[model samples]
Target: MGGEGENMTEDAKDPVTYEFRDGAAWITLADAEHGNALNEVGAAALWRAIQRARADRAPVVVLSAEGRFFSVGGDLASFAAADDVSAYIDDLADALHRIVSELMRLDAVVISVVRGTAAGAGFPLAAAADLVLAARSARFTLGYTKVGLTVDGGTSLLSATLGLHHALHLALLNPVLSAEEAHRAGLVAQVHDDDELDAAVDRVVAQLVTGSHAAQVTVKRLLRGAATPAPETALRREALAIREAAARPDGQEGVRAFLEKRTPVFPGDR
Candidate 1:
């Protein structure tokens, strides 16, 4: 991350930017204008970026974002605009699941740097990493329920990371957590002052890059092995549930209400 990055993706406007800098692979969420919303295209771009990092066998892989938000999760406007929202979301979830799976299976130390907001898919992506570093101003949330979608992007893994009731809190209430709050909940490994984040991450990355790569990968695999539901199974279930939910009346109402900036009168409200 410290070096002047050489472009890996041909177009600078891709959803993600991948580069080998220093001794690590840096993959940044580059679609900042729309809060780095994940859609099929972005998810595919992210998967390719992760694959590049995996292929490089980088000892340290850094996942970060540009602008204010890490990622706001799926693109609701895009879904609402699609002729078949269910199919669109299904494809999106499939793509995102692959990214999450690849990131977890990568034989490197993955670190997510959270500067602002990391909600919905962002939450699980960061949580899946070996370590998560956050700026003091960082925030986290899981607002899928607020939009009447079940959830996807490996969010089911939150239970293993945050415990059952805490995961439920995120899924049901959609409460936003400050970086300090997330740290207390064990999602964040380290928190730094807003401007000090890079330096802090740099130190950790330097340490990781010089450390034993096999030992690091072994540790990650061991811990992941202990996680319940097998992330793959959970991801598939989430994708199915989300696709079904997206086709439901509640989900449609939620998306319409969101784009219209109004309260959703879901089917249950009748």
Candidate 2:
């Protein structure tokens, strides 16, 4: 888990954009049309962006997305199209977990600015950060149950941080929670009205950059150590569970139903 292999070669067409300036590294998800859905390619690009921030020793890293969604999580269309859906989903899960692991180990203050929906794997993607700043328009949900897949991207570990009741509710009912709801549930650090979210994030960035970097980093490590286990094992469990689920009849019908824009008739229904 030290390193998640070399990142994909940087390309102009990658779905993530990384830029370092003013002591902060900005990593923006750029695949708006697809809602920045996590796939192997997008995951690798995101990994590269995280690695770049690490290389630069940025004091603060801001993770944001250009799309209406922070990310829609796994791309169901791709899942349905995969000739080997289980293998494909396993690979995607691994790729995303790699990113989550890196974020957990990163020295900088990792902040995710969520403006819209953060569903499925997206929930953990935002929650993995050291801080989550969200807009009033933001929403959070697991969404995995809807598609008959288990949670991945460190959700299994991260959800522990969110407490059992909240996690159970999300994993079971798949209800969408607003940013204020997320804040109330201790899932987000701050929530501003949509128009003011960027300004709020900028202010937080300034404070993080100007504060005692060493102290903050040490606190990050200390709190994380006390809060949860290493992300690798829990994440691996999620990845494996997802793969097995994806190979089952419920997973098959669920993914197909999602892609077909219809209600999923899960195994229990039959």
Candidate 3:
């Protein structure tokens, strides 16, 4: 279990303040004094880390913050200091959205371990995870409207996953929901005692690691395909994805192993 904690200096003022570790890549919003506000550098770091996690075939990844709140969305202080608000906002949104979208497309499972408050972009980032295990003390809110701005970072997509009416209420009302409520509303997968969250996450990750990588990737692609376009179109993607999986050497080995009642020898195994 490598430590998912790193401190890197970027330029002179804006430093890269997150870390990736073990088979589980992670990004922690460490600027707690500023509410773990999302900034351009942090967003880019997270995006790159996600890419790394995919290339390395990490079993599971977790996103958390080291503070009372997960993140207060974007860093208002940096935005106000920027000379070009429009460009900054666009760049920030693009990076953040890319991270979330990539997480969705990746084969490895992602989990959000929300300890306390996860508001604005934080909420959607959590929602984007394949699984969200929120601490009993965690609370979530789409706090964009309260700050006089529209949503970003797949907030709309995350909201839509919970159905239209509930999403609309979240966007319009911006009221916070307890972790248990979030689970009941389908926003989060489970809620654990704050002290037991790390163990719960570890168990989930272990379960994911025990499965066949080929099957996991195939199913993930199928699910994503089913979510997009009409059933006919989704079925086409599913067929294509399954066909590709079947053609792989590992898939062939798996079938043969099942027939022979032996363990499958996956590709690249010695």
lDDT by residue (tens digit), candidate 3, 140-172: 998554444566766666534688788788987
Q: Top TM-score: which candidate number?
A: 1
Count backbone clashes in candidate 1: 0
Q: Which order, best to worst by lDDT?
A: 1, 2, 3
Ranking by TM-score: 1, 2, 3
lDDT of 2 by residue, 77-105 (tens): 88888999999999999999889988988
lDDT of each: 0.88, 0.87, 0.68
Clashes in predicted model 3? 0
Against the hidden true structure, what lDDT does model 3 obtain? 0.68
> In terms of TM-score, how similar is model 3 to the real structure?
0.76
Best by lDDT: 1
**Tens-digit lDDT string for candidate 1 (46-134):** 88888787777788899999999999888898999899999999888988888888878889989999989998888887777889999
Model 3: colliding residue pairs: none
